[model samples]
Target: MLRRISFYVVIILFFLGGCSDEHGTSPTSFEYEALPAPGNFEITSGSYSLTLSWDYSPENIALAKEFFVYVVDPYQYGGNIYPVDTLTVAEYNTSKGCTFDKLAANMEFCFVVSAVDLSGIEGRRAEAECGTTSAP
Candidate 1:
């Protein structure tokens, strides 16, 4: 009886330990390098307003997850980090790449992307990031 119980316990432990999550995490993003810059990046359609788009390269982009673009207004004095209000697309587009549906016409904004990792240890920031949201 005792032997049977121990065997079952060991098997359960092994199964639990071997389980792998869909999203794998890298211990430290220090080694993770940026993708060779975003492709098909550009300023998309607007009411002559500010719009930005890119491939949003992430160092460790695991399956079943993706990045969210952000914008930073360095001139506005909000530090040097911000999430882009507009632009949402998983795969990169060849022509427009990504698009900001609507925005304040003639406004200024800078944009970037951060990976929403499942592990939640660190936010995946892109190195090929760029922005030019200057007031028009």
Candidate 2:
């Protein structure tokens, strides 16, 4: 009986020793700083498309790896926003804007642009710009 009790006590001590309140260090414990949002966001309507343009400071351009464009069809989904496209910093700098094509004619849409850093952290969205495509 004494030997069995000793074995049980050893098992209990082993289990208790494995449990601890302190948590191990996490692999992704570093904080991420978000990039700044793009400025001067504007949209121009086309036959069945919309062109979006925005400005970012040279300092911000150096930090951002890409830009994310989001769109909202307020008439159809009651202002439900969704990501539409992503443009590399080089692409944006070359064209100075992004074009969203193949849209419904004469329909109104809203757009916003955000900057994304190398770490894939997205910044706040710019002020929304709304426009209507030309009738086909």
Best lDDT goes to which candidate? Answer: 2
Candidate 2 lDDT over residue span 1-136, tens digit each: 9999999999999999989768877778677678877888889899999999999998889999999888876766457679989999999989889988898999888987899988888988887889899976
Which stretches of model 2 miss by more than 4 angstroms? 1-32, 73-78
For model 1, state the Cα shift of residue 106 in Å: 2.4
lDDT of all predictions = 0.51, 0.88
RMSD of each: 11.8, 3.7
Top-TM-score candidate index: 2
lDDT of model 1, residue 33: 38
TM-scores, all candidates, are: 0.41, 0.72
